[model samples]
Target: MSPATSRGPKTPVDPNAPGPMLRYQSNLPKLPVPRLELTLQRYLQSVRPLLSDEDYHRTEQAVREFEAPGGLGQQLQQRLVARAKDPKIVNWMEDWWLDQAYMGYRDPVVVYVSYFFAFKEDKFRTVPAKRAAAITTAALEFKRQVVENTLEPEYAKGEPLCMDSYKYMFNNCRIPKKPSDVAGMYDPFKNTHIVAIRKNKFYIVETVHNGQQLSTNELEQQFQQVIDNAGHIPALPIGALTAENRDKWTEDREILLAAHPENKAVLEKIETASFVVCLDDSSPVDRDQLSRACWHGDGRNRFFDKPVQFIVFENGKAGFMGEHSCMDGTATCRLNEFVCDGLNRNKINHGSEQVRSGLPAPQQLQFQVNDKVEKAVAEAEQHFDELIGKYDLTVLAYQAFGKNLIKKFKCSPDAFAQMVIQLGYYKMFGVSRPTYESGQTRKFQRGRTETSRTVSNESVAFVKAMENPRLPNEVKVAAFRAATKSQGAYMSAAVNAHGVDRHLFGLKNCLRPNEPKPALFTDPAFAYSQHWFLSTSQLTSEHFAGYGWGPVVSDGFGVAYMIKNEALQFNVACLKDLVVGGKTYKNAAYHLKQCLEDAANELRDMLIADMPAQAKL
Candidate 1:
């Protein structure tokens, strides 16, 4: 087990004690509403590097007026504090953040909101059915722990994180509604079947048969049956509707229900399943191909709204896709890590090898369609193809050095990696833009994430120093240390629920519909400062080959990285034709990959030159 998930020592447990997973949940502190003065001060400090001198002055004036005594800022802060102090409210910003950040958004989830994790190869199980069965067995073990609440809660720096999100991790699916989407959670005890998709066809494979969970060999037999029953021909691709725009899909879903009396039951079967396993027919050989396959497959073979989908390809390569509505990546990361770790260690119980005789065949989920439904599916397929064709993804598996070397320099590995990203952006664009690194706020009740603003003044200074040919190694190293220090401090503040973004978000949401807009919010610099040119985050695991998501903005790059013991991995995603300053940059993902490699090399060289001669060994 990874250190983060490992329980160091055993302790006696009382029979009446709460489950280990949620033992501390009731006692977790509520997310705090930061003081108005501190928020504005930090806000100004964060935007300084992203704004020009004139813009900075105007923004400063707006902030000054907003935070004056008896001003609007103070009023909104009071309302937020009152909401936080309410006994009925667990977390002040939880509902609003969910609505604004996820549910209310009308875009398709495939390229816009979903994320993927590419798993390392399983050398011992290369056969597709065997690989799928092993994954399903391990995943069901995890599901058992989660359903029974027996899993240990994750910790960072000795404090337990919120495990509330795990309830949505299994037997859950996102339902498309008109104004906003809602999450549906089925009873885990009752929903013991999984839906497997192959050649655009869906099948129901019961994980539990005759009141007992199927053995690995039985599960493999069921999967093989699904593959054979699906045949070589593709179905009508009803699942493609899931990848269409929210409103469009919402309307078409109603049509589907009205077209046939059996459609609703069929849909319910998929939504209430324990999870999804996609048996892809195509084999992806390279890192890029594998990432694309995992990220967003040919839109036909996926039911995109399922919270957890394990995708297995023809070559036995596998990965996972996550819907972002109900939980953040941390919860799913732990689950995936657990799955990988258990399988790699050969610790999962596969049950008896003897296959049960006279087992039932996998049930095919058939959707009856009319002319309108058929037209909708066709349009959805075309739109999905067009939408996905515009983006590019590239992976850089840097084996030069990683967390081991960063620790030798006496720096936080995450902060150091953030600098590597900043330096890479500066190298390509010749200037720094606004950047966002996700900071988990799970220490607070019902918490999700806070923005750790990455483009600080200190970071700017460090990048510029590295760019200067005349700068000495000692000077560059000094700047780098200062930058990492600044990053570490801000990240600490962010995780503690004192970051500028969420606090400001709460205050902004506090405004009544009829109230006048605040000058601080109307300022152009305010929006620009939050526009993430580099949307970056890190989730590391030795069992992961790659992890990534689409960029938040059209012209930006989504840079997801991993800092392993002896290597660093970066997965970059952006538009294929990214236009900046009237210049069209093709293959932007490849360029960013090269820039990241160069920046990593330069930073390592500078740090090594500054090290003491005896310490170099």
Candidate 2:
């Protein structure tokens, strides 16, 4: 009678899993043959720094490991090599490790950090989703007005390869409610683990419990146990690899049963992946508390926070911040969808068919973006004097970051008031602003005698005529108005009420009704920490993939990351070291916040002063 839970065709198991789980060995992909890019000592230098403890004894031990007679020579720990060899599973695991290898290979500090995540609760519940969707459709339809405005088309050739290399991530992995829970450090002993795209798909992997490694048969049985227990994934349409012959494919991983008929159970065992509901929210953690969670050991001032955090407010409400480390805008949206699915009990009945497979292989990044942005930066100065004052600050910061990734450049601590003020433009005597229909319906009325339509309208625009280098003052106002008017009208109405004897109204505005209203004065806080966007994890939409992370411990869910290339991507996984009010951002956070406000307001005043004194004179 209740809505049937969707497990979708997989053989059912008792909700209460019964009996012993099996064990299995996974064959791993071959690592690229080592060509020795650097000397043993240098390689040791690279991996040594990863271990924060600099005790001469431990450092000496590592150096010896590096200098072993035949070279560390991928003499991967014998047990590790053996355990990492399950081809089907290990191949995917290798690709996952590549995506996460930015910190260092074999860095235990980064590996063991990914263990947990808090439940994510939806926070933006106030917005009416149905209405928001409608508005999105309308805005996107203005496709004719907006341009692609891409900076470059192809940054690297191997990008697709890199994307394809990790098809497993696209298929079997989902960004968790917090990526840090699975990032940095990994424990080979954990039982059940999940990854996701939030509200889209959830990939579940139940490892054979205890310290014993699994054999393919054991793994197959355990996978079945999961299918028997995890409930059906509605849209996921989980495959019943249990049909026995799935593994007989001579050509690689085709559904084993599709090839051979009798071995269905063994193949189906591996195909037994399941999905859960979507997670539905992004919210900030306590800034102060989180800073304390990500700290380097031995009183060191620098702390590598795990780019994301999760915390419960005093009211027992759960919230999280996507630390800027593990994810960027491009990566966050995919994650947000995964979390949403978990919160909503949504499952990937459908495969991860829509997304990029992830970096399939090694590739280069487009370093030219800086050049294009540089041109834009230069032009900004000529059009708006705001750049004149910022010429020093903007250029300096950009260059500083380029030169030193680790240095912290603290702003002046001196206090100063900052703000932004808006003044509406007027015709003839004052300035004018561009107008795109603005307003909303106050209320709807329905009565036999009352008019069939209720109208709400307000028209306001800003117009500023500035003297061009070659153009005369007399043409300024007219030129400005013409430029603004070029943006044509969007709404056209016909009198539907003509036959009914009353006017029927339909209105469309560029700025949607019920959306966050535009406020001239922004809240004074740090220049939004670049991490404010962290709480809005899974920022990606359709175009790009963004992600980042730090290799450190955090008891307070410290490090946070955010990316906003096109859509948005972000993640907030916990760590044991980063703590709130730590030096990373807190050192000069308040100072920068003040500077940004002052900077914007100062630019505004400059614009007013630069306007032509007499329009059409």
Candidate 3:
């Protein structure tokens, strides 16, 4: 299956429909609130592997008291169900989840909340301008389809996924605010240009010129002009202020606006642009370097709030950085897949080669820098350097085997990958910890994601068996099968919006300020189980060299993986000074990469030795 397309039976629609992207949206079901008993039961099962016997007993007592007949759990459940049935609310958890999970979080988005995708090299376009132009043209075509609402909706399991998040994909920017950020969406019809950053200088590159969209050659000319005009020296790095803490940026923004009247207009031009293209001067030679560059480049030549930014390096290497506030990875993944696939297939229209006469010169966005503004910029740059310097990221492209081999073992590819991560962590730490694998919840209206807890009793058993030298091959194989089965079950529940985490989150949100807190909410196991020591997610594409995000917790590792046909790609990210259990993990990302490779080989070897010959492909 194409990475962009989900598995689903075809649902016929009229060819002449006006809003194909949103046709089924009204008929889509609302996100359901799972039954209280089922949620409690699953919650206990999820935490079983991470708790001791005594801790387990206490958790059991907590669950019992919380779910006792006519208890607080039932009251919270009632409130959640009532909210779900509200006619005005499309999804009961939408507003609260957005606020609590994203907008309300005040960290700098660059290294904390944003994510990146390093594209596979494009052999045909080796020049930076050529590559940037091609990427821009392809992305603009995608924007056109989205703006016209003619893009076909994605499907999973014979049902259409929600297409609502696509609205935030273009001409949108996340604005800094005091309490919570707000998403600003400009009218697509009015935003005819895109912002381009080079040498810490910003330029307005008009995508549409002379009442027509610019051709690939025209875009190349414009990008080249911007590059040439930017000169060799870097500018004041005003964009670095966006990489500061949310509150700091919010304050600095006011100072910037107060510094000059025209500053507002300059900000508006950037905020309202269709998207951003960063023409970076660095040449990244390897996967690690590319991933880092795309993840958070210099942190000065980037406006991190833009929802979509295509970064092109001086060596013609290109990748994409996505803002995580308004949309999830699935939406941006599709957008990127469309761009790369379209370009690779030569399907995108490059337009006429002729550059039209009297084309408007690229407009440089000049910020009025006063003493205060310059000081703010300098501080931002220093802070950005300090913040990014503390994190290390490594990409492991394991070519031993991938989905093709895993399928021969009768395993779900994703489940097998999850086990690989589990075993890798076990090999390093000698125990399983809380692990989170993101599952898409787009089957429901305005859906985003739910946590698929990966560490289970079965997984613990499997990992332990693998670690034990005395374990027989048959026993180890059986344990592996059971672990994958358990992982698949929880993942199914998560994607269906019946997982433990979000349901518990909703129940907690339903609690009144004056109400007594339930023991279940205050349980130590509850907090520990959700700590997510290994934060993992998968978004695969053959065209991607690497993709990842920063860890959610300071001590945890953010593991983003891709399972390709012949290889598995893992991007492990964590703090450089990682300390867990009083022991500092120097070069943790590199250690995890080695563990992953060993685990993959061990699993393959065990299956080959124990499984029946007929099962082998």
TM-score versus the correct structure, for each prediction: 0.98, 0.25, 0.98
2 versus 3: better lDDT goes to? 3
Model 3 CA lDDT for position 139? 94
Write candidate 3's Cα lDDT for 1-617 as tens digits.
Answer: 23233544354444555688887776678899999999999999999989999999999999999999999889999999999999999999999998889888998999889999999999999899999999999999999999999888887756788889999999999999989989999999999899999999999998987689999999999999999999999999989999999999999999999999999999999999999999999999999999999999999899999999999999999999999988999999999999999999999999998989889999999999799999999999999999999999999999998888888888999999999999999999998999999999998889999999998899999999999999899999999999999999999999999999999999999999999989998999999999989999999999999999999999899999999999999999999989988899999989998999999999999988976887774
lDDT of 3 at 28: 75
Error of 3 at 145 (Å): 0.6
lDDT against true structure, model 3: 0.93
Q: What is the model-wide C-alpha lDDT for candidate 2? A: 0.23
> Best candidate per lDDT, number?
3
Question: What are the C-alpha RMSDs, in order, of all predicted structures?
Answer: 2.0, 28.3, 1.8
Single out the weakest 10-residue window by summed lDDT for candidate 1: 8-17
User: Worst lDDT window (10 residues) for model 2?
Assistant: 412-421
Cα error, candidate 1, residue 26 (Å): 0.1
Stronger candidate by TM-score (2 vs 3)? 3
TM-score of model 2 vs. true structure = 0.25
